[model samples]
Each structure stands twice: as C-alpha cells, then as structure tokens.
Target: MLLITNVTAVTVDSQRRIITDAAIAVKGGRIADIGKAADLAPRHPDAELLEGHGMLALPGLIDAHAHSDQALLRGAADDLSWRPYLQEVIWPLLSRRTQEDAQISLRLCMLEMIKSGTTCFVDSIVPSHYDFDALAQAVQEMGMRGVLAKYVLPDALFGRGESPVDTGGFSGEDESLADAERGIGVWHGAAGGRLQVWLGPLVPREEPPASASPGFYRRVSRLAARHGTGITVHFAGTIDDPPFFQREFGMLPAEFARRYDLLGPNVLLINGTWFSEEEIPILAETDTRLVHSPSANMKMGEGFAKVPQMRNAGVTVALGCDAAANNNCHDMIREMKAASLLHNVVMMDPTTLTAEDALEMATIEGARAIGRRDQLGSLEVGKQADMILVDLKQPHTMPIHDPIANLVYAAHGGDVDTVIVAGQVLMQGRQVLVADEAAILEEAQERGLALLKRAGIEVAPAWPME
Candidate 1:
C-alpha cells in the first residue's frame, strides 16, 4: 500500500471539486480511498508515505488520439500542406519503415507523453509492418497505459475518387482483418490488463471505387460490438473529403456514416474538425465521441472544430496531438493551451472554454473518448491510481490563486514533478525511472535527421520563426 498525503487534490468529479490537505491511499494498484489527510493518516499506518508538499494532484491526462508511430518523423514535414505531406511524403516514408522502427517510435513517444501530463493514450495504427505486440511491449515498459489499435484499411481510397491505385498499396478487407486479428490475439490483454485492443478503420470514409467496400463499416461495427471493444476512424477533417460522399452517395460525410449505422457508443470519430453544424446534433443524439486535435487541425489549415458547440451539444470532446509530423510535438499541455485559445478565438468569447473545462477535456473526456473512463480518468477511489503532481513552486506557477486556472492558462509539462500510474511511480522530478531518457533522445534525433533526408526537405525553424 502507498499513501500520498499533504497534497491539494483537484478531484475532477462532476462537481469540479477540489479537496485541500488531502491524502490518497493506493492498494493493489487501485485508489483505495481519498479524503482529509488527518482522517486517513491513522487508517493506513502501514502504507508507504509520499510527502506531496507544494504539489497539486489531478487525474492523469489522456491523449485520446495519437499517431504513436509517427514519433520518428517529428520534424520532417513541418510547413508542408497536409495533402502533399500525406501523399507525396509521409505515406512513402511509412512504406519503408520496419517493425523495429515502430516499437522504438512508440517508446520515444510514450516517454514524451509521460513527460507531459498524459498517463494514457490511444495509439493509432501505422501501415508499414505494424507489430502490435512489440509496440505494446514498449509502451508497457514505460509504465504507461494505452489502447493499441490494429488499423485496417480495406482499400486506400482517400475519398474524392482517390483510390489505392494512386498510392500502389492496396490490400483486401479480409487480409487487413486477418492482420487485426493477429494483433488482437498477441497483445490485446497483455501487460497485466493495462492495455485494451480496439478496431481501427484507417480511413473508413476514404476508399477508391475499385477498392471501396460499401458494407465495410457495418462489418467493423459488428466486429467491435461482438468483441465489446471500440472502433476508431478518421472523419470530417479534410475539405476535399466530404465532396466524395456528396458526389458518389448523395449525402454529407456525417450523413453517409449515419446511413450506414456508424454512430454510437462503440464508434470514436477521430479529427471531426470538418463536421458541419447539421452533424453536431446527430453526434449528440447518437452518443458519439470526438477527438479534437487543435494544433494539427490548424497546421493542416483545417478550420476550427466547433468545439464550444460540440461540447454544448453533448458530444464527448477529447484532446490529442495527432502526430509529431503534423503537430510537431506530443505535448498535451500545449494541446490544452491550444484548445483553450482556439475556442476563445472562434467563439469570440474568452469565457467560451473555462480552465476547468479544458482540464476535463484532457483528463476525463479524453479517457472516455478511447473508452477507458471507468478505470483511468479521475483520481476517485476505485479508479486505477493514475495521477500527476505538479509542483507549485516553479516561478511561472508562483502566487497561484486558482489551481485549475493556472494549470490551464500557464502551467506546463515542466511543472510536473511526479507521475503515478497504476500505483507505480514512473517519473519523479520529471526523471523517468524505467526508461533511458538520454539514449532515447539521441536515437530520436538520429531517426528524425534520416527521415528529413529521405523526405527531401530541410527542417523548418520552430513554430514562430521566419
């Protein structure tokens, strides 16, 4: 048993409550209890104690949608438009990568994720030889939890009549399903039940005519319902995308998905930045969740996702970094800040997104987006012991008037001093204990340089440079 006491715990419950001078008891990798420190001190006398002075505890952050394998190409495609980057560069580079690269990429990404406030993530699938088992193995070694998706693209149609023939990498639906099955069998329940398996339709709405399977979505829904797992697919992010459904099927993108019975609890709509107002009500009524990636959407020139409207309409909104090449970083705090800023600009009201709401999206809603809300979202009793302690003594964090406000508006990953997952200490003082930080950084830099050369591009200066 372990007891973390003397911390100001912001239990992000339905009330958005905060408990001062609190202590949390962890037993058997689960939060045993949480209450006033003085009351619980004598109850758990034998448990190991962790002094949490000058700390603010909150539920572990979750990255609902992430391309974990893209960590290798961190800076390779900055300043490039999304279409050319995806077609002319990323896909080609992806075809040449190996399983080893995928695992190493996941390791590096998970480390970065941990350094940020993300204790959990949903890792999207990649094309080039996805060794799901090896990927899970690497993430587990970091004491992080994730839902590993085995992405199956029945055909490579990116909508708008673009087919796999354009890319020269097409596989049958059955073959892709077989690959998913193999991945599920290998790592679905591995890592002491810390990992979950989910079905990934790489781009459900994007398939060429010859390769497109009209009934493919129904099959995916059936599989997920049968297995009691989640189904994730990219939707409504590309402007060029919706026209395909309009021309070919005479329906909008969201309408097309709805007509095929693709909206519900099991379906997670990834990157719904292009969703129309008409689609918002459908998502709300059908109980569909969304993965909102602000930085990537902006970088790709995708317009703002109607975040305030989506939240108002009862859509479960979660934050993600998308991928390193697209967003250039896996920092959830930056994502959080982006989310708040974007909503304020779009809504023309600084109060549109509150600090508390931003924190909720990063924690509870994010966990729900990937279907892990019951176990990993909040710091409540009976949930897995996953939370981060942010040091309040940092100069930027000094004179903190409101904990949640500072966390949302000003606090960064560097302020996080401790991370606990499943009652295990993964990092202390921002130093990861289970992984080699220096070596991982070294390899990541080497791989990134190689990726830039292969993609035939020079790295652009960091975000605000000329």
Candidate 2:
C-alpha cells in the first residue's frame, strides 16, 4: 500500500477531473481512494508516502501499436523509403534474430518505455524465430501490462499489389495457427493478469493466390472467439492496400472486415492511413479501434491519416509511436506532443486536436483500444494504480499556466519522474528499479551491431570517416 500527495491529478475520468493538491491511496494493486491531500493524508498515515513535489500525476501512457522485436533495429535503415526499408532491413530481420537477441531487444524496449511512463503497451507481431516464453519472462520481470501478440503467418501476403515481400523461410499457415493456439493456452493470463496473449494476423497487399484462404479471416475470428481473446491486424495502411482490396474484394477493407465479422470492440487495426471517408463511419458503428501514429506516418512519408475526421466521426482513435525502427523512440509523452501538433497543422485549425484530447487518447482511449479501459485507464478509485509523476518544476516546464497544455506541448519523456504499474513502482526519479538499465543499454548496442553483420547489411555513415 502507498500514498502519494502534493500532486495535481489529471484523472481522465468521466468528467475529466483535475484535482489540485490531490492525494491518491493504493491497496491491493488498485487505487483505493482519491481526494484532497489535506483530507486523505491523515487517514492513510501508515502507507508508504512518495513525495510528488507538486508534480502533475497523470495516468500512465499506453502505446497502442508497438513492435517489441524491433527496438534494437532503430536507426539501422535511416532515411530509406518504406519499400526498401521493409525489403532490406525490416523483413530480413525476422529471419536473422535469435531468441537471445530478441530477449535483449524486448528488455531494451521495456527500459525505454519504463523511463517514458509507458505502463502498458500492445506489442505487434514480428515472427516466430523470436521465442515467446523468453519474451513473456522479460515482461513479467518488468511488471508492466503487456498485450503480447502471437504471430500467425498467412498462406501468402494478402493485399500486396505493388509492394511484394519475400516469405521464403516462413512457417506454413496451419503450423502457425497451432503454435499461436499453444501460446494462448500457456501464457494468455500469465503474470497475475498483468499480461495478455492475443493473435496477430499479418495482412499483406497481394492478390488471391498469394493471400490467405477465402475463409481465412472468418477462421481466425472463430479461433479468437473460441479462445475468448482478441486479434489485431494491419489494414488499409499503405497507398496500395485500397487498390488491392478493390481489385480483389470489390470494396474497401472495412467492408471486407464486415463481411468476415472482423469489425468489433476487441479488434484493433494498427494504421489506417488510406481509410476512405466512408470507412470511418463503419469503424465507429462497429466500435472498431484504430491507432494513430503521427511520427511514424510522417517518417514513412505516408499521407496523413484522417485523424481529426476520424475523431469527429466518433471512432476511438488512440495514439501510438509504431516502432523504434521507424520513430526511433518509444516515448509516449513525445508521441502525444507530436500527435497534438501534427493534426492541428494538417487540419490548419489550432483546435483540431486539443491538449486534453491528446492526453485522453494516450490514457483512457488507449486503454479502451486494448479492451482494458475499466481497469487500466484513469486514476479513479477501483482502477489499476498505474500512473506517472511528471516533474513540472523543471526548467522547460516552469511557470505552467495550464497543466494539460504544458504536458502536451512542453514536456518530454525525461520529465517523467516516476512510473507505477499496479501500485508497484517500476521507476523512480527517472531511474529504473526493475532491471540494470546500463546493462541492457550495453547489450542492445552489441546485439544490434551483431544483427547487422549476420544479415550482411552494412550501415556506413553518410559522411566520410577516417
């Protein structure tokens, strides 16, 4: 049990309350009570007290779309376009990494996430070469909520009209499905409900012969229903995805999803960059969740997602940083700032995505996307005690007029003073307490270079070197 006072709480509650000089009490890994510091401090005198230093206590940010396997691949293919990077650096990496290398990468990514106040994340799938048990063990040690996805390979890449990827050594579809089912049986509810296993079915832009069986999605849907779990997929992400769908299905991806019963509250689509105007309403009507990754979309040079329009259309649009290989960081605070500004500029309206809206997306709406909003989103009573302390007394964040505005515009990942998940402190004063941060940093540097060598992809500095 613990007590944190002298903090301004951004609850992200139903009323979106902002409590000044607030006190929050935690017991049994849940927020037990919340009120004024003067009112609640004396009641919980025996609880462990953490000095907030008048910082802003907000719900821990959630990365809705992440790649646990790609953290070590950051900056490996800098400045390369989407197709070349996917072909040369990203796809080959699926075959090149060993299980040990994967564990190190997962730890490295978790270390960054812990520092940045990311208490929960949905790790997108990479490949089966990376071991799941080792990855789950690493996440268990860190104590953060992880939606660990089981990668189920398709018969061929669906929707891959213009850009085609090589799947030479990939496992067959039946074997992949069986392996994923085994993962759900073993690790679905592990880590005392702190971890969840979900299916990650990869969707490519190829035609019928290269695509999965016609009944593939319906089959996966039934599989997920039988397991009582959820499934995530990438859809309508690229410029060619819609064209491929038109040539194959005679409709948009959302229509195709409807045909196969894929649209639902439990399903999460990664990036809908090319989603047409008509598809936004379909997502809203079905309660389908979509993650908006502004930095990654901009980095890939993909057209801006209709984020403002989607939000206006009542879609549950949460924010994500994608992967370290693309955005080069796993900082949700930075991602929030990028999202708040990017949409405003794109819409040419300063009120497009407000500070409050962006923060809500990072907190409550993010939890909703993951189907955990009831237990994980806000700093309300009966919710999980997952929150962060932002040091607003710092030089950059000094003289804060509006806490939410400053958080979305002024703050960065380093301003996060503490991170707590399930009432357990994972990081304090920017120092990670769960693992050796220095050791993981060293291991990631070594393993990242070794992976490049193993893949025979030399990355020389553009400038001449001695």
**lDDT accuracy of residue 139 in candidate 1:** 74
Shift in Å, residue 7, candidate 2: 0.6
Top-TM-score structure, candidate number: 2
lDDT of each: 0.80, 0.85
lDDT (10s digit) by residue, model 1, range 1-466:
9999999999887776799999999998899999899989999999899889859999989988899878898777776776777776677667656666677788889888888878888876645265666677787788888887777765434443534222324356667676776667777767777787888775644433433355877777777787777888888777767777787788887887788767897788888777889889999988898888999988878776788999999999998889988998888887898899888888789999888778889999987787777887888889999999988777787788998888877888878888998989998878898899999988877776776676575666676775
Predicted structure with the largest lDDT when compared to the true one: 2
Using Cα atoms with residue i matched to residue i, what is each candidate's TM-score against the true structure? 0.93, 0.96
Report clash pairs, candidate 1.
157-206, 157-207, 157-208
Q: How many backbone clashes does candidate 2 have?
A: 9
lDDT of 2 by residue, 1-466 (tens): 7999899999999998999999899999999999899999889989899989898999999998998789989988778667787887887875678888889999999899999889999997845557788888889999989998887766655334432443324446677788888889998888888989998876645632456345777778888989988888877888888988888878888888888877798898888899999889999999999888889888888776898888898888888888999998999988988998888888889999899989989999999998999998899999999999999887888789999998989989989999999989999989899999999999999999999899898888889999
